[model samples]
Target: MARAPTTADAFNAVAEPRRRDILNYLALAERSVSEIVDALEMEQPSVSKHLRVLKDVGLVDARREGRQMLYRVNALAIRPLWEWTTTFERLWRHQLVKVKENAEKKTNL
Candidate 1:
């Protein structure tokens, strides 16, 4: 089966590393296309393309500020992603505790 495009949903949209980076950058503050491009060290077209995918998934909001467009993360839209991933938090903590216990045993040996 062919893989769905990144614009399909929040999960797919954020699956791309570059898109995740873009989201992380935008999380701090709104940024123009050029600003994203420069901060990410990506080409202008590439940054714009990622922004378009992010927008389609509702993970980002874009607004016009004079001739420039500013983009920011849509926190509400990202909640689903956060909720889904955090479901594994407990499992991760359990595993970490096991590892810590084993390390402590070895150090005492």
Candidate 2:
């Protein structure tokens, strides 16, 4: 089967570690490309590439501010990814409970 392009959806777009890092940074506040490059210690071109992919997938929004372009995460566009991951939250909680019970049993023995 053919693999989907990173720009195809939020999932594919965020699959890249760099893209995730970009999103995390943008989560805090909107920033210019140079700000991201300096903060993340990445090359300007690389950051720009990742931002383009994220924007194409609607995971991010970019606007011209003065002479530079500022980028920010689009929370609404991330809803599907958030909803999907949350489904696993219950499983994680259940596993944690089981682990805690096992630890208590060992401690009491």
Candidate 3:
């Protein structure tokens, strides 16, 4: 299947590790472009480019805060991605339960 453009959806935008990093950082608190650049140790232009994609996909929102642009995660826009990933939550829980059972049996033996 053709890969969707990063701007097409929150999932696609976050598929890039650096973009995910930006989102994770913003999840803690809103940050200016320079702050994101500093936290991620990424070049300003690269951070800006990823931020543009994230903003385009609605995963991020930006507002002018004085002279700087502050970016933050849009939780509502990210809900779809969260919902999709959580579909596997039950499956993960089941597998973890089995592992725990096996470990208990070994310890008791």
Which candidate achieves the best TM-score against the true structure?
Answer: 2
For each candidate, the alpha-carbon lDDT, in order, equals: 0.93, 0.94, 0.90
Question: How would you encode candidate 2's per-residue C-alpha lDDT over 1-109 as one tens digit per residue?
Answer: 7999999899999899988999999999999999999999999999999999999989999999899999999989999988999999999999999999999999999
Choose 2 or 3, whichever is better by lDDT.
2
State the lDDT of candidate 1 residue by residue for 9-108, as single tens digits: 9999988999999999999999999999989999999998889999999999999999899999998998998899899999999999999999999999
TM, every model: 0.91, 0.91, 0.88
How well is each residue in 39-93 modelled by candidate 3, as lDDT tens digits?
A: 8999999998998998898888999989999999998998998899899999999
Clashing pairs in 1: none
Kindly report which residue stretches of model 3 are placed more than 4 angstroms away from their true locations once superposed: none
Candidate 1 to native Cα RMSD, angstroms: 1.3
**Best candidate, lDDT:** 2
Instruction: For candidate 1, give the lDDT of residue 84.
Output: 92
